[model samples]
Target: MPPETPANFWGDMPEEEYYTSQGVKNTQSYFETPNGKLFTQSFLPLNQTVKATVYMTHGYGSDTGWLFQKICINFATWGYAVFAADLLGHGRSDGLRCYLGDMETIAGSSLSFFLHIRNSEPYKTLPAFLFGESMGGATAMLMYFQSPPDAWTGLIFSAPLFVMPENMKPSKVRLFMYGMLFGIADTWAAMPDNKMVGKAIKDPEKLKIIASNPRRYTGKPRVGTMRELARVCQYIQDSFEKVTAPFLTVHGTSDGVTCPTSSKLLYEKAASEDKCLKIYDGMYHSLIQGEPDENANLVLKDMREWIDERVERYGSKNL
Candidate 1:
């Protein structure tokens, strides 16, 4: 309720200036989807030829801003155009704060925007990659399942939530009790808070910065959110064989938020001919943003190399 001490994510610098300093052109806009008015941002290489387009999705309680932009900028600087949207109910998007009652509708909303951009001129023929981090990985997977065949050339996941660890799974009894309320408590922020940020970020300084995000949700999980995630994780696990796109899934062995078994499961079950998995020995869940510089860069380097190789193999001649 009080004034936020930090004016922006990166020191006192203006947003556009800071993005320019990072060697990427930044643009923010509101996208009107049938489900909600979504806050979206695009990061493009300043003067470099675009190699491909990367559509990104941030995790639960997170948005496309904050350190998430670091990933976007990194992709853009590597000659890719990156675009991201704040998932509904989080960040500047329209909805009850931090509530996710319907996972399909939420995934659909973001998918619409990504499809629009991917189908437009100068990009339609070019290779497009769908990238997701944390719970955003689940959203991205849903989007992929709902999309037309071949809609995305490839998929990249960082510490995705395709599998929920035993400790993090919501109690069935609790959900049943809440269900007795006839769905009235669906939007309530009453689910157990697993103190996920504490387990997801390894670097203490970076953790502080992530916690300072004004738009980040810092409340207990919503009833429907946990319920839907549990349900959807099972659904995605069952549908793993449906994945046919070239893909790379990465996880941290020490990640307490999402299980490293997530990546392993996907790699084993997916039908994709070209699938890769990377499990970092001691990295935390937020591989790209919460890790120390050398570590984050290490993850980023792997991501860049993976995407670059795919681009060369399947990329288009278009800008």
Candidate 2:
């Protein structure tokens, strides 16, 4: 079982915590991509005079609603027009949950939506930023590296998965042995020894809040998800030098899933001129909730400040 009592992530969002009007203002609607497939959730502010707009992409096996409603509302309060959408396999989107069909499909749809929003009238020249967490962070990096220069004003990554924890590093000889005996060792080799499952957050209240929501925990990972993760990790490792956008990366020192050292290595390796890395002490993988929310909030506030500075210096004409 996946831990009977973990910390509450959303803080009392026990089932039926539907999107509230105060934060998410019922502007949620779906729009079609060039490929003729309709994705879900294009939320705009009821009051559209926000200084900037933030387009967020969610992680694997996760949807836009519930998971990001709190974050979205917080950003909206900070004078941002936020738009968040469920990725291919998750939520109401048309795809298999917890699986990867085509990585390009996921990345392309996001790029298309971003372009559509950027080209629209009011938001046309606004300073826009991309914020992602965990798997979403990985996707945001991929999208940033692949897009043209100035695609985003800046990027805020919360515990990006540049690499899985070092403990998961199997001996090459062991992998060879498994391959020889099994013909082909499955990529879905279960990490029974990996204690990352329920260890993501350290607080009990936050875990309860997260668990109470159904969209947060839906299905188990597929072989395809693992394969895609490997591919993206490899891509990031190989092309860290290709990244040019300003980046603000945050991770927890006590993270059980993606190691904090991974963020260190990524920060050291990226070629961006402006980069900041903040590691929260005693923080688990999920920094948004759990104890030490203050530290994470400071980090996010600093991210917005950094983004504002970059926008002022670089300006929308450049980004």
Candidate 3:
């Protein structure tokens, strides 16, 4: 059974009480990477045997703090060690705010962090999994492609940006113009009408908390950032069949940011023999964070079951 919240707690428990109830040891710090210094947080089970390790990455303009940390806490309670890194330009990481200059550099920085933990003492022998949410999903997939086949035990994606939804996609003319203007003012914010936070989160209170996050980037998308995102999406789609790792992807049917068709396409085209896809009927993009309590719990239940089964079936004997 999962940890129970204290009676005094209301909508959300205090950080100390929450971590104590979950029996998790939490830590946060900054680490240097080739691209820039990155911030990372980890949640490890206390007085319990860890069954697996999950290296996570947050979505665009988001970080390891705020609602994203909630999922890490749950994983720790379930006997899994969770480590998450703030992508460059998000959270406390050093960079231009929400500006993704190059996909390769961004993905490479995460891969380096993950590999460090995977190859470290104690964790070196544990079965490892990659968990990516939203744009982080693209980086996770790219990391998988960059790694050898047996490097990770499994991959998990939540509302992955495999394909940008029609509503959220930028105009082709704008993209062309941006590409030409890349030589100058590449860092200028271009696409400003990003109402994704409103569309993605269903709970009004949680939406407020997310919106109030000081580190959250509410500015328009940058020219170089938008261009790179488009290129990355196209590359992932073209290389879907190249994904041979056992994996599972979950997306909400009502998601307005990333299309559900992306996960469907991955399921149909991926070469992985052991792969699964789950679509929550009316849920929004923020599966475990933005939904009502009941719906969020349901998504969390599915994710836990899927991950637990894999850990049991493929015990931490091989990498």
Candidate 4:
């Protein structure tokens, strides 16, 4: 953020005013999961007919608030009801900050709230999609795998962590050393700090804004977090062929965090005949939020078109 920027990413305007100015209604609440309480937010168009429902998940160390909601607000403005939650160990939710010991349990906690809203009135009948970015991409896929058949109409992934880039991958030797501790070092923040924010973001100004998020975890990757991600990422890649839902996976060729190759793998391996993949020539990992307005808008446009067609093809229960 610039020196003149307010504590809030959107400036001194009240949150409601800020969201209203963005042409969306924003509501915040606490969701009780079997594991713990989660800070949740829902965004919806004020006067437009709801087209479809989208359950979104934010990247690691990021919450549903802050600059992350840029994606949610954009979707809501496009007539989709967007719902997101801070993961179990991140943001204002319970547990140690950014400590993801068990990927399955963490995914389950967030999926609980999503299923509740998805099955509830007004939204249950509507076509629904799962959206995720960065590490959340893997989490969202896990939710999809665990979800009942036909529970989701489609899937969307942005710079998913299905394949780990050389530099971003945690050291196998280090993880093995930690593993020798027998669950002792699982929560320790001793893993290498990859300076991911610097790499994942392309715009310097947006980097400052994302770095300013008070809820963002800036510490070194936790021992268990990296270990589990390594394991689960492979698990996700192995399950790619089982993905039968219509889906769109996008990646920026220049992304320094997650590799675009993994996204291509999903497109190549997935069983969905309707699956689509778009590889942007020179975008960053945070395609929708970290890129310049023009670039971000381009990505959003593709997303809008893809989703509108999916809703039309599948038919929304709302209609």
RMSD of each: 1.6, 4.7, 4.9, 1.9
Local distance difference test, per candidate?
0.92, 0.67, 0.87, 0.91
lDDT at 305 for candidate 1? 96
Q: Is candidate 3 or candidate 4 better by lDDT?
A: 4
Clashes of each: 0, 12, 0, 2
Residues 116-167, candidate 1, lDDT per residue (tens digit)?
A: 9999987888899999998999999999999998889899999999989998
| lDDT tens readout by residue for model 2, 1-319 | 6844322343455423333445345355566765434355554445555677787877655567654556666677666777777776666665555555357677677767776786676776788788888788888777776677676777888888878665654445554555565634344443234434467767776665655656554444544456567677777888878766778888988887787876787789888898888887788877764445676577668766776676677655432
Candidate 3, 54-137: lDDT as tens digits: 999999989888789888988898999999999988989889998897988888898898889888978888889999999999
* TM-score of candidate 3 relative to the true fold: 0.93
Regions more than 4 Å wrong, model 2: 1-24, 34-39, 42-48, 167-197
Task: Candidate 4: give the clashing pairs.
Answer: 1-208, 1-209
Model 4: residue 141 alpha-carbon error in angstroms? 0.3
Error of 4 at 296 (Å): 0.5
- Please report how far candidate 3 places residue 225 from its true position, in Å: 0.9
Superposed by TM-score, candidate 2 places the C-alpha of residue 293 at a distance from the truth, in angstroms, of: 3.8
